[model samples]
Target chain A: MTALAERPYGGSRGGPQGGSQGGSQGGRRSRGALALMLPALVPVLVFSVGPLLYGILLAFTDARSGRNTETSFVGLENFAELLSDGDFWESFRIGLVWGLSVTVLQFLASLGLALLLNQDLRLRGVARVLAVVPWAMPPVVIGLMWRLVYHPDAGLLNGLFGTRVDWLHDFSLALPAVIVVGVWTGMPQTTVVLLAGLQNVPKELYEAVSVDGAGAWRRFWNVTLPQLRPVIVAITSLDFVWNINQFSLVYVLTQGGPGGRTRLPMLFAYEEAFRYGFFGYAATLGVAITIVVLAVLGLYLWRQAREAD
Target chain B: MTRALKHLALLGYVVFLAFPLLWLLSTALKTPQEMAALDPTWIPRRPTLANFADAFGEQDLLGAALRSLVVAVATALITVTLALPAAYALARHRSAAGRIAIGWVLVSQVFPVVLVIIPLFMVLRRLELVNTLAGLTVVHVTFVMPFALWMLRGYVRAVPRELEEAAAVDGAGRLRALAAVVAPLLAPGVVATLLFGFISSWNEFLFALVILKDPEVETLPLTLVRFVGPEGVARLGPLAAASLLATVPSLVFFAIIQRRLRSGLMAGAVKG
Candidate 1:
């Protein structure tokens, strides 16, 4: 991922020696660069970096939402509370289930669609357009539309199945129902990314495999899988992070509803902050969730990179 | 047999992807009686535009839409203004600081808004900017800045340095060279970035949810969510119609960007 940005461009206009040898010129150039950067950097520092640091500190405090509330340091106390918080553990478990299942399902579904789109097939343009149209959709609209689909009485899901199942409200089905929406909403990008990766694979490898008497499945396993691994790793890790951090889609779909069945980690943190107004605790929740997700992601990416090497 | 199965699989995907959308369009057009029927028809027996009319007539729908438009336009303008020069710097100057900036852009995407937002809310409250569209616009700018920078930098890189150097050799100053030599070349990228920023801000929900507490300031997505409250089937048609309407800007965005998107240049821009 970093490599994309680091792909060396053409001549550096101001070389390293240009500064020291042409001292005044270098100083002026440096000042100009800083000036160019400051417009974007200042807002990022104030609104993003500063708040992010303050939020980390807030995780160690007792900062509530009210104006008159006394704020005090409560180092690791919230963490202690979090450890014993049964509701939180339940929500975290639900979050893992939601994140893992959605990521996996989205990957598989998108891979299938991407592979199909990469084929020499008729109506390819129309299919490609249809596949990507969802990428353009607002998540809120996607959520609301799916809610219509899963509506107990008036929903298309019930109408098609000829069975009355309150998909989003059912204790057993709500998670799966929301997972389907998550997959649908996420498919276009995953498919597009994977399709791009697929298109990049050398056709000669497929020819070599075929000449060696490899069947289609064997060719895919040996040739396609190995070649696509980097893109797979990048996109899937991103998908996992995006899935766990997903709030708006699930929020609009079920509002963590029918007993918080659809509450991903981000949704859980949102509730802590907004619904209940426990600002510090919410920050703690957010921090804890990020550490865990990053650790998992780091391990996964490390193994993949090592394997690639 | 395999070809038939391939066609079948392709058809299945197309149906899976398109069905919900078609269903949404169907719901928007169905009459109340059709929506209330025991069995829902794929095509409405009695189609009507009344639902679309009702969607507009709904309380605050039009106002909320206007608010959404305002925020989106402001975000697009501000995001491009900030991202353009920053992108130019990152593209031209391969400094350690530039590398760090790129690293920060990637890292920023990983951090949860929940983490930043709590402290941000307090900061905004102190600034007396909470519950204001201006505050919401600022947040959207930061939210989109990373990806917009990434995209615009790519576009900047796509414009070869020779052109800028040629302009420079002709006695154009740095800013002059950029404006005269680079800006026109970067117009499509600028428009793409603007559309992306606009769509993201227009569709943003969670930040707006936190920032805009007053119903009077609620954006379109917030207002649309309100329509889905436990009011039952009475509100379904309008909700569907409104949902369909909310998708228009993004559809137009996609139509324009579809070719560039297929080039895979903007792959990293979307969250998922």
Candidate 2:
């Protein structure tokens, strides 16, 4: 933290200068600050907000793909279809399963790795970057790598283990296989966040508890858990959001195949819009996915707010 | 756990983490017959570079890679240029409007990229950027700017505002004060954000896949995904070769600068 403000003039020169700035200067500067903000706001509104509002409008229309389909206004027809659609509901349920499995498992494994890395081990620097290899890889590449490994023939998983299992194609194993890769590629962010959180926990708390005859587990429970709650909350919330929308990996790995068992909501929507020429219906799916993601975020913020109170 | 056990566990992690890349390397070097051999050797008994020759020669990925590079560079340049001023405002003003902007950016992160695609595609179509690298770069600017701005905000906050004030007190103009005082200290964030924006644009697939219909305009990721058609999975050797080629730049970049990235993120976490 000190590295940020480690300027030579920080402590000594700051106070004397503030006194010379008159009230009139402050007013002009605040307006100038707003002017400084203008460029970013313009693009954010144009590119981000404008497209988003247009997307929401698109969801309520009959904007199907291909030349034969006409673009006409429809009031929640897409949504009503989604409500009764069996495949859509199935994907939603699987989306929750996929999101929870990846997020929860990713968080636990990252915490464990973070704790290990925090220790003064041999080759600590090497281990740190090694763990990040998968995280740094593009999902398309990672998905392909695993695709080769999970092959039933000429495959390492089967070759090394002496078993025959089609990891990506099997009905029961595909989702789990996808989730395992999800944890592998998603670990670095959580580890970095938790490690950052771990540093904030004071050494004296552990020392004082040790003197009171507290064991390692007790110190961890009393000192570590309480201190890391907010960070944990933030990281897991992000993990859930990320995992829920995961598409490219699954798309490359299985394309939501084996009867759509591993099809995430994003993949489902992508297939709908692009594959089946159902652009309007796909827009509804996208909105539904957003609502679920926003709900997850909303719940986290609410809980955090309550905790702060 | 005992210290020996701890070291052993670390070894396990290293092996587990390194295995896939190792396997990929082994595959990339193996002969086509060896890849199809009943008993695949862990080590390619006779290594070959023919697959890479095929990938670069026949598939012509060099052109696709060059296209990816142009898009990545453009995305990084535009994102950093815009993000610097916006992040500066958030760091300096701390007004109610700034808070709302930050919140809005965070909320945008959770919104599905799919939602952005349809509308973004229409806009790009209208502008005739559908298959153009320029269009892909513009779309990436929107996708990447929010996170870049947020991270830059943290880095900007870490810079002491007084340093700029001290320059302004010397009768320097506002732009001159920023160029002199803030820009140098802003180096770490800029470099980090640049790498981030570059890597992200290089790796982006969905929008590029949608917007760029013609093979001539395809980026690296978009071209790579084409290997999975009805032809028995692009032949493992060529696939592995292409993947490794695509993998090196971002992986090396991450290994080098992850510490700076972590510290910047932690600073942001501390504030939140």
Candidate 3:
């Protein structure tokens, strides 16, 4: 679908429209298109690109403890500070673990669920809708809900097991607890994508695989997995970006608590900028996150290109 | 034998997904004494809607829900309004710039809301739009526009350009053709886009949390968060009830649009 849209058909069709209506009508159409695009584009540019550029600028300066206007250039000092800051490095490692674990677990869970739902099973529609509940819930709500579920005293876990475990309070358990919520929140969208991919795989191939005495696993590997590669790449790349940026769940659940053990770089950045008033340092972290996201995207696109070839 | 195993695995997966939700519903109905029992059980000992009553009375959840609905509906309307024409142009106009515009839409989704939140905070504060539904709506529209455009663009492109061109040749203006002819065929797409945009805005938390500081303007999610007091102590029964209430609109929306979602998926073949 996307490929066809990108294909260039020549300028000959332009002649009919061009001759019938000279510059004025064409100008009007272009104007109309611009008008339609401006409302959407302005907010995106102002909020997204504007901040990104500002953040990048802040990373190179010694902007601390004031509005952005008070900043002066300190040329890579923030990045240099980040390089030596063990806390920053530690948070980076935590972010890496959070991103990779959540992304991998989410992909697997969703893929498994998608494969299951793709089968000729009863009540598959119900399963699909039910699965999307987590995704539909706000992240803050999911975080709070899970926090309740994971609470030490009266949580569902404690109630079910009759043993108290501090899921979010324990340093070791905190990250995983947050990651579980992340996985739950992300699984639905991934499942939807994978289900779409699975549907695209022609049924005849599966039938053929079965007739050839290929088992379920064999059929999946040979037919389904190959067919789902593009979607897998897309979903995984998206998961990486989403997981890297995840803040609400962690914030609401732990606030990077138990001595910053659960602190992902995003939480670290927030605490630095807002709480600690280290705007330049936070901007540096934001730049680092952006770099990692772009790198992951670059890698995914390259893999997608190779897969296409 | 393998088929049995596969079915079993699926059943297990279903249980995993459904159990937490069931627990939430049960907890919402349980009496406080039953809920606080040392040996807790899944089924409520004395099932009642008292918890729900308490939740509403205690939390002002009904008001928050109305605010959420207003924001979600406004965001959906504004996002679709802005995205439709651009999506239409990208669909019908075969140009290099149009292709780039489509790709750019995908790229826009990659930037994290957290990165934008700080600057947006500053921006909104500057405009004196903070803590207002209007402010949150602007943020939601910006957040949802990319996905809406991407989703609708594919569906719009699927509607044969010849149909709109035929209408144009019949002396219909582009806007008239789009409204009278092209739109009816693209109803499924429009619904799907609206559902996606609506849900995205409806579920969004970060922007709402940062922008809406006024308690009166709180969205459902933000209000739900108020259930948690300092040090992570939460009022479970009320929280569960509010959670269930918060989910009602989305579930209703999903039920109404599920058929359109399916057809849109099949037609566009875009996973979105």
Candidate 4:
């Protein structure tokens, strides 16, 4: 979802904040500009906006098919029902744990890996492209591949650890297993972003710190961390949002199984919508996800707006 | 860390990243005899291509791939074609409406695909597009258009304004100037963006699963997932084999555009 391409946290490059005032400023062709934009905007309006609003509207209606299969409006009934659903709350809790673990872990791994790649090591370029291999993989392929690794019998984890645990099936092990896979696949862009941030960090600052007899940790904490802070915060926050929204990987690996232990909110929403045909309930779940995502990203967007001003 | 230690750490990371892919490759080559063994082996004792053959035999990988290719290419082309004008306007012209459009694109990026997928599925069903490649392509266009528009806007912003102005000064219309002067310079960006569009379409799962129900019309991802038995056990060998094949196009396109992607990624960092 442009998550990979746009994973570079923050540097004010005219993203959603509209920092590009460099375009055509003439009054005569404002109409021309509008005309030019019409084609692209039309599809977004037709496909994206229309459905999003419809989905929200569906949330407030009796849109289920099982017992009460009417499309009549029932204001906040789905949401109120959702508030009391233990399964929804359980999914949300799992989602929070899942999202936080992946985001925090991915950030640390990406930062460390980025630092390693930023070093003047030979084959760093090769490593750079190879690092992208995981990111380039289809999420489904990743899920399938990881499922084998987590296989109960003759799995690689078993071979490596001398244990017979069914990683994706064991209730205690399922979420962690899935989290590790999530971190693995989500590593590339964050690493790239941090690596870029590292490379762009002026060399003179490093030399200056080194000349002052600073150790590596001191230098990093004093120089690198501060320099990378905005990027770290930005990427980490976006990663959190992405992790919360992730569906395919977890769906593929466990299908939110092992007694719903790994049923993230997305999978829950999906099951509610497709599996049970609870459109209204599922739409409420969708709205909940959107609100969570917006809340997560709202901070960054607000900052971007302030910066744009 | 010392240079040796740093390289050691880096090597560790490379192993971490490469291990799963290596395992997938090795698993695809392992014979059923090797797979059935109680113990796992690092290298397959009797590496065979039979799993891939079996995978191909089971599902029409070639047909599904063809469908995927048609859909991905169409999505990329249509998205880029539509986004080009929008990107040009967004990049070269800063009006209030244009700004709002950019903002909308940003919002669309984070808008849950699930919310839209249901209704889009309904709309496509009504239009008899539920199982067609064309229908799948249109759905993907909506998914990718915002990203393409924003990314290409960044690229279009990088193209110097003077080139278009120079052509316009010589009696060329604005559109002609854009075509003659700006389009050539945008080649690398277009390639990279199109590659991303292709990858997103090819890798997409939920929309395809929801919309395309016919086996004959299923994409590679759908076919691959169908390998799961009703008992819910995935056929690991054949699944890995087919997965490797499905991933080849994206990996190839990735390599083709790696140089641009590195640059584009750095330049394209707008998704917060």
Between candidates 1 and 3, name the one with more favorable TM-score: 1
Indicate whether candidate 2 or candidate 4 has the larger DockQ.
Answer: 2
Give stretches of model 3 more than 4 Å off. A1-48, A62-69, A122-125, A207-212, A300-309, B258-272
Docking quality (DockQ) for each candidate: 0.52, 0.52, 0.36, 0.48
Each prediction's TM-score versus the true structure? 0.94, 0.94, 0.88, 0.92
Share of native C-alpha contacts between chains A and B (below 8 angstroms) recovered by candidate 4 = 0.48
TM-score of chain B of each: 0.93, 0.94, 0.91, 0.94
Which has the better DockQ: candidate 3, or candidate 4?
Answer: 4
In model 4 chain A, the worst 10-residue window by lDDT is A1-10
Best by lDDT: 1
Residue A138 Cα positional deviation in candidate 4, in Å, after optimal superposition: 0.9
Give Cα distance to truth, residue B42, candidate 2, Å.
2.1
Q: Write the per-residue lDDT of candidate 2 for residues A244-276, one digit (tens) a residue.
A: 988889888898988999988998999888888
Q: Give me the displacement of residue A54 in model 4, in angstroms.
A: 2.1
TM-score of 3: 0.88
Which ten-residue region of model 3 chain B has the weakest summed lDDT? Answer: B263-272
Tens digits of per-residue lDDT, candidate 2, B1-272, equal 78898898878777777787888888889998998887768899999998888777656598899999999999999999988888888767756677778888877877788888888877787787888999999999998988888878777777787788799889998789989988898897789889988888888787787778888888888777777664435677888899999988888777766777777665545544
lDDT of 1 by residue, B100-151 (tens): 7777778876788898888878878888999999999988987888878878
